[model samples]
Every structure is written in C-alpha cells, then in structure tokens.
Target: MNATRIGAGDRPRLYVSTTDTTDVTGDLDYIAIEHAINGEPVSLTTAEKVYTAQLLDSRGLTPTAIGRLIGSDPVTIRGWKTNGWQPAPTGRPHKASEAGRERAA
Candidate 1:
C-alpha cells in the first residue's frame, strides 16, 4: 500500500494506491459490498455551499456584489465568473472551459 499527497500552496490532493493486485481488488470489492449493504446520501461541503451561494447571488447582481454577499474574495469570484455566470444544476454539471473541451476531445 502506498499513499501520497501532491499539490502546491493551500490546494493539496491525496492519492492512495496498492501495488498488490489482491489487496486492490479486495479493497474495491469491500467498498462495493459496503455501499450495497448500507447506502449513503451525498452531502455538500462548506466550500460548495459558499460557491453555490455566490453563484446564486451573482445571477441578479455583479460579481463584486455577489462576493460581498457571500463573504467570498473578489478574485475567487472573478475566476468563477470567467467560467460563465450560470448556476450549476442539481448534482455536478459540466462547467468546462474552452480549453478543457479542446483537451477532452
């Protein structure tokens, strides 16, 4: 089993892996069994809530106004603005940029 953390600055990501095939397969099988036995509901995190709020407020207001209302920094709100000022639908929607679409293709 191996676990690694990678990222820079305040944003960091975690990656976990197992070299042993049996261990990996067992882990996945266990996860599937657990989910089947006891299903769990998905919930939103604080950051997601904040982003949603900001997006909602921006619908009828400027980015600065939305940022102020949601207690988010202007720069972060600006980045979200560049991605199209549309509220995300229920569940995760594809909010891809031009470059992202190109790369995906």
Candidate 2:
C-alpha cells in the first residue's frame, strides 16, 4: 500500500501503512537485522523481536513467515499478534531504590 498524507494543519504527516516488503525492509540493512536475530544485550531482545514482527506484519507477511525470518516459532508469533506484540517488562529496580533516589534529590 502507498503512504497517505494526513492532517490539514500546517504540518501534514506522511503515514505509511503498507503491505509492501520493500517499503519496510528497504530502510533496514542486513547488519541491523542480524543484530536483532542474534538477540544480543538480552534487555532489548523482546522489544527488538516485537518491533520486527510488527514491521513484517505491516508488510503483509504471515506469522509463519515472520517467525522464519526472526528464528522464532509460529506459535510465538501468533501469541504476539494476540497480545498486540507488546514487549514484556524486563525487570524491576532494586528494593529501596526509590527511597535512595528521594534522599539524593
């Protein structure tokens, strides 16, 4: 699909809601995709995966196809779709961390 320009205000925005892989994949290089596939740093992996899934989904790719691209299972991809592909929380701050911050302030 083509990008649509919205808003009648001074600053009109170009919104792309496409089913074309080229429109999505063209902006990403091989190295960036490789980094996401590697699941490095641990913390950002979930977000990376979810974001990639959303991009591929917008490009008219199937869950199975997205899973294949990202080295994940189709079931997991389906779950992402069910839950809106939101990344889970990584972890919580340490106990007393808020108190410590207040004291510092």
Candidate 3:
C-alpha cells in the first residue's frame, strides 16, 4: 500500500460542523469515490474493504449506502456482516505467489 493511501480505519465518522461549510472526512471519501468512478487505478484490498464495511455497519449506515461508498453491493456487505467481517473462504484453493505465499490470483 502507498504510504499516503487512506486506510479503512483512518477517518472518523463525518460530523456536521457548526460554522464551517465543509466536512474534511466526507470530502476525502468523496474524492476517493470520484477517483474510482473516473476509472483511476485506486483500489482497496479485501482486508481494507472488510474493515470499512464493519465500520460503516457500526455507524448504522444501511447496506446500500455502505455499498456505494465501498464499491460493493448490498448482498456482499450483508454477507460480510454474517461472516463477522472476516474473509470467508470461497471454497477454492488459493494460488501460490512467487514468494510461495498463498494469495488470490
């Protein structure tokens, strides 16, 4: 991961400001979303997605909202919740990397 990439746990829930017209956290998320929508190479790892999914779930955001933010569907988000946000096995064996580490191919 890049040193500057926003990790899933990095930002707090966006709060309305009393005087300012801007919410930094929300702005950052929007920027990321725009970049992704523009077909940029920004990608979140599965672990990152899991962390964010759990965070959003805890914040009471519905599956649709969380899915829009995280670039997944409501079904997948619900499945992650059912599995406790841990990566559930797909029942297929993982491929071995050149370093002999098992990873999704």
Candidate 4:
C-alpha cells in the first residue's frame, strides 16, 4: 500500500509505503503527518540590512552592481552607504534581560 501526506501552504508532500513482502509485523501503510515544526518567519528589514552589509563588505562592487545583484533601489543603497542600518528582528522575541541587551553599554 502507498500513502501520501500533504502539508500546509507550499510545503512539500510526504510519501510512505508498506507491503506484506516487507516488514509486515510493524505498522503497515502509515500516513505520516506533516506540519511546520520550528516554524519561523523572515523579516524583510533584516534581509535588507544583511544585503547592505554584504554590499559594503564586497569592496569591489559599486552601488549599482550591488543593487542589481539584490534587485533593490540604488537610492536605497546610497542611503545605506551613508546611514548604516541593522537587520530587522526575527519573529522570535525575548526579554531584554534574557537577550543581554539590558547590560550597560
């Protein structure tokens, strides 16, 4: 027997199979449940900050080159060149104490 399991959104499907010729003593055909284990979301702000940092570190690339590579605005790149930015916080949140952000600078 063959079984297929679907997941939410654009997640990948899971497949399983069993046969009497195979290990029949165990669970036969099983429909494995699929879910977003350790689900997390990306922050576009963080992505922009990371991309800007990478562009700054590339050394050889001009603003236009970096913008084309990342499909962003050259004006944005120019702004980043002047006013640095930080990546947006990920969905995971923690207390300031837990994150060690409360310590004296």
| Whole-model lDDT per candidate | 0.42, 0.59, 0.61, 0.42
Candidate 3 residue pairs in backbone clash: none
Which segments of model 2 are wrong by more than 4 Å?
1-31, 34-44, 88-105
Against the true structure, candidate 2 reaches a TM-score of 0.43
Give the alpha carbon lDDT tens digit for every residue of 1-105 in model 4: 965633346654422233332224432212211111112222233344344335343546666665554455767666655655433345878777866765654
- Separately for all candidates shown, the number of backbone clashes (residues 3 or more apart, or on different chains) is 0, 0, 0, 1
Residue lDDT tens for model 2, 6-89: 323464332223343223445534344444433322222455567677777886888887776676787887888888786444
Off by over 4 Å in 4: 1-53, 86-105
**Residue-wise C-alpha lDDT for candidate 1, range 21-71, written one tens digit per residue:** 223334233222222222212233334424444435444665565454445
Model 2 lowest lDDT segment of ten: 13-22
Q: What TM value does model 4 have?
A: 0.31
TM-score each candidate: 0.28, 0.43, 0.48, 0.31
State which candidate has the highest lDDT: 3
Candidate 2, 84: how far from true, in Å?
1.5
The C-alpha stretches of model 3 lying farther than 4 A from their native spots are 1-42, 91-105
Task: Tell me how many residue pairs clash in candidate 4.
Answer: 1
lDDT of 2 at 94: 62
